[model samples]
Target: MELLSLDKLAARMTPGSLIAIPADYSGVSMAATRALVASGVRGLRIICVPTSGIQADVLIGAGCLAELETSAVTLGELGLAPRFTAAAKAGSLTIRDTTCPAVHAALQASEKGIPFIPLRGLIGTDILRQRADWKLAENPFADGADPIVYLPAIKPDVALFHATKADRDGNVWIGRRRELATMAHAAVRSLVTVEEIVDVSLLADETLAAGVLPGLYVEAVAEAPRGAWPLGLQDLYPTDDAELARYAEAARTEAGFRAWLDRFLDGRSAAA
Candidate 1:
């Protein structure tokens, strides 16, 4: 894997690229997200594995996205993601509404190099009806008129996230976050930001190897200390609820969001 500066890593993503991002509780590369925003990359299409929070909101607020496919987008305790809500209300964003399981099934299908995967849920839900790509088919194995949903594979151009650490050999330890592995496997390339890099080989240790995503899947890595700031990295830091609250409040208005974005880009906000 190539080691790169954070800005350079962000630069690798081109306009209108399809990117897969994990949920907030997972390893979110907030630092890299900031760099991407600063780089002024636009017309991105984001696929939140299941759901997302501040990371997706920040990108949408910055006018970097043209389409979004996800199960949901919320700021958790901080309330609705103001910018996302505003964009959705104004019909400025193309939204592909999906269910949590459907998102996972689509990625899994791509990981296996399959064209589509059968899902049992969403039989009577509006999510199934709205998704033109998802087709309804009768279960051939079933005795009667049982129907199933077939979700087309969703192969992203890039999978981006943060991790606790990586080894010199470029293997990233995601601990129990297996979804990150799924994303890397399904995407064409993966970009990672880590809190640190160690000299030892992560795959050499049997225990560590179990939680590691091999370097084969990683295209690049950047050393970004506290890379998951304001969103928290498991066992390293807590989510900056205060900062999230401030963002939620400030983003309620378009001008307020612009002002907040200025502080964010200028590195004058909390934890900057």
Candidate 2:
């Protein structure tokens, strides 16, 4: 009902839940994710809207993911996402490799409370061939020449992410990154970690109101300073480039990943 601890908020998510996380460049609830990993939460079906990075890789490395639905997973300048790449290569992960628009359209379908959404393109692409769940058909509105791809709605059990701030009432400020709002709208529950929890309502200001995701959509909120660690939280701080580079290197091998995980968990524990 009130602001929860990171671990407590993570505990609200059941094992094997279909969890939707924000894109690579968008803010992710890494602090809450680390808490979940520490608590040994497993069998999660992760949906990385559009793309992913450290969040997906860390979950894969911790053996917490059963499936990953995303367009791509890369560490940007740090190179490929090691654990995700390894898992895909070893055939240890069930991947739904679709295009970015497809993922976004699926979420939009859920947001609209529709069974499916039709999008243009992907007529002869490998993405369409790989995704058996997707279907193709002649466009009803076309003159027998147009084709469309139908993406099934993706209604995640929980939407998890980090925000710049949240009011005491639990509404979060996501700024211009509206995909987080879409995730919250499409999921059954929305859990967020915020850099700051304020007493005043963000909606009182018209400028901030436009970007505020009302508490009605948010199930729980937790105050976690630097909650999006290693990833940038727009206007708050930049990504930890040095640490991301270290993660990319260490997660290259199982042995190296374990060592890195140990140090990471230890550091997290100390911080807690």
- Top-scoring candidate (lDDT): 1
My TM-score estimates for the predictions, one after another, are 0.97, 0.96
| lDDT on C-alpha atoms for all candidate structures | 0.92, 0.88
Model 2 C-alpha lDDT per residue in residues 67-107, reported as the tens digit of each score: 99998999988889999999989999898888888888899
For model 2, the run of ten residues with the poorest summed lDDT: 263-272
Superposed model 2: Cα runs more than 4 Å off: 268-272
Candidate 2 vs. true structure, TM-score: 0.96
Model 1 agreement with the true structure over 1-272: per-residue lDDT tens digits:
99999999999888889999999999999888989999999989999988999899999999899899999999998889999999999999999999888889899999999999999878888988898999999888998899898899999999999999999878999999999999999999999999999999999999999999999999999999988867899899999888888889989998888888888776667435
Q: How many steric overlaps does candidate 1 have?
A: 0
Best candidate (score: TM-score): 1
Candidate 1 segments whose C-alpha is farther than 4 A from its true place: 270-272
Deviation (Å) of 122 in candidate 1: 0.5
State the local distance difference test value for candidate 1.
0.92
